[model samples]
Target: MADVTQLIHDYLRHNKKFPHVFCAGCGHGIVLGSLIRSVHALGLPKDDVVLVAGIGCSGRMAVYVDFNTVHTTHGRALTFATGIKMANPRLKVICVMGDGDAMSIGGNHLIHAARRNIGVTALILNNQIYGMTGGQCSSATPQGDISMTTPFGSLEKAFDIVDMCKAAGASYVARGTSFHAIQLDRLISSAIMHPGFSVVEVFSPCPTQYGRKNKFRNAVDMYKWLKSNTVKVETLKDPTQKPDDGRIPIGVFRDVEEPGLEERYFELQRKLMGQNR
Candidate 1:
């Protein structure tokens, strides 16, 4: 209900630590802006919000925001976030991770968390490489792409995070790029408000890593690629089918109702306690 832009401005302007560590033209800033706006829209108490970030460039986000923030080791943010949400269902737990963190070493945890329908919103900043680790090829790295680990070109296929989340039983799954500002903000808000596991895969650009290696001059050029390549959901279904032209689909792919993990845990606890009495 609040003006999303204003809310983002207020949060970033007042928070001295934020927008500083975030690299100029970094998608982390965009996603953080959208996330702050989403939290403002939810009208949740500041004390009740918990932000968990995994190790990476994106992980630095936790250090900036004013909240119950945790910056954990690589690929473990979701696990910690899930535990926090389960222990205190009243808190709003959000897991922020990079592409490599969520899709590589964290893949198993990512899927399992979705399978359990943990009441935690997971946001992946998919920049397609291990940016902080010097541009190693990550699971989300596009096929035939070049990185520090793949000097010639990567032979492995890239993981479609949205599809993977949907298959893993996430209650809500969406994909948005940094270019789609309004849609990203809305999707993030929806993911946060969802009752069960929710994933918002944000296709961002890693200018310092992926972009430079691939010949883009800077981050703005990478943004142009994101803008030009992203396709609308209404224009087509089955986003897995890649067009020869290279357009990528970006929108809410799937949403279904499911019992959240914390609620089920409490229900079982209640029954067990009754039996003990």
Candidate 2:
């Protein structure tokens, strides 16, 4: 109770805004809480944190936080965050994006961000369907899942975000479900602390647009599915571990210390200045 009060007092904005725009039972709010708790636990100065969000339901997150925030255009959160980081590398830049915002229109930006090893944390919310726009198919939607646009079921393969980011050279990458909020809190904190480009794919629940179409009774059912279907990444590495029964693996997939683009850029600048002198 005290923690909750502190979180509100320290992190949340004091604006007399109306209720949040998320649908009832939406896991986005849970994701937001996890983020707030992670930042609070880290004891970072609020002024040092910059939260940039892309257009979508996820974009709304920027407005509610007390930290420096930007609601950028769709698929451009990374670009804005990169510029912000380059301008003031001391600031802790974070991006919040929906799956479509991160992987579809913004896919190219995501690749470049990871390739450049920018010093920014990307928190991607994957609710399987486009919850903000119509309940349509998105880059993270499960293959053969039904949505408004895929009434007959989608044939397109969903992007394996963890593997994609790992292959793209992200210094740190992890995945967590809204059902596992505590673990998510840890993953987010780790991502923020990681030096290079960090990606944390959050499997949030879009109860309004996704659960009803998928035949889930309610948000609780969706959460249960997440718990039952996900296996810890650590379990997969254990030699004595039993079969995971094909459950989706969650937890840190990669963590390797590497100099970020900002560090390299400033290093080059120093060398150029020395050459001039």
Candidate 3:
């Protein structure tokens, strides 16, 4: 990873934009930091990187970074990213979306993208609630959790983003949390390098909206919760770690190398063009 000072100087926007829009302890800031370091560490050119975001708290991530950013409609960031990838297969497209933005209205697009195995990185920041709009229960909100919409606790089960992407045929799928900052940095880097559809479901915390409503004392407590309620993926082999009902696993869940959608499409076009000659 690049030096902290250098990472900030190279990736951040103008210095005048001091206080970022995120809450004091919101995990979104951490995610942004990890993302910057990951991109810098990989030595990717700033111009070559395109960051696409949807309508949510996560959408604001694009504004602070110096990368080519596209802020699209609710749950449709993937569509724009797909278009960009098809037009220029060499560009590295990364979509950053909040849990509600990625899994709710945008769920169908995500499934189709994964099914096609497109060459784009989908970085889904799963805060588990509709933080920016209202403290509403999102598709990722845990069952039996209170929210603006689910006053009496949500009866619907939360969507497992990693499993969904893997089942939908994405070439790479990984899970990481804001608490594990270093791991998240590595995970994001790996996802960007992986070909075909890549999904990195990051369990970010919404201290302002989701925290106060839940039992969390504060943002620090939320980070502690992430640390306690999750286990590393490497430790799953032992039978001693069998009962992990509430505790989630954190690490890469799936990875496979294969040709992406654009590669296949362009290859077909090339073959047809040659045939016509």
Which lDDT tens digits does candidate 3 get at residues 1-277?
A: 4378677767888753767888878898899989998898899999999999999899988988999989999999999999999999889999999999999989999999999999999999999998888788999999998899998989999999988898899999999999999999999999999889999999999988888888988999999999999988787875224334768888988889988999999999999999999
lDDT of each: 0.87, 0.91, 0.91
Candidates in order: C-alpha RMSD to true structure: 2.2, 2.0, 1.9
**Clash number by candidate, in order:** 0, 0, 0
Runs in model 2 with CA error above 4 Å?
16-18, 237-244
lDDT score of residue 168 within candidate 2:
96
Q: How would you encode candidate 2's per-residue C-alpha lDDT over 1-277 as one tens digit per residue?
A: 4677576556777673746788888888889889999898899899999999999999998898899999999999999999999999999999999999999999999999999999999999999888888899998999999999999999999999988998899999999999999999999999999999999999999988999999998988999999999988887877234345868888888899999999999999999999999
- TM-score of every candidate: 0.93, 0.95, 0.95
- How many backbone overlaps does candidate 1 show? 0
Better of 2 and 3 by lDDT: 2
Worst 10 residues of 3 by lDDT: 237-246
lDDT of 1 by residue, 32-105 (tens): 88888778878887788899999999898877777789999899999899889988999989999998999898
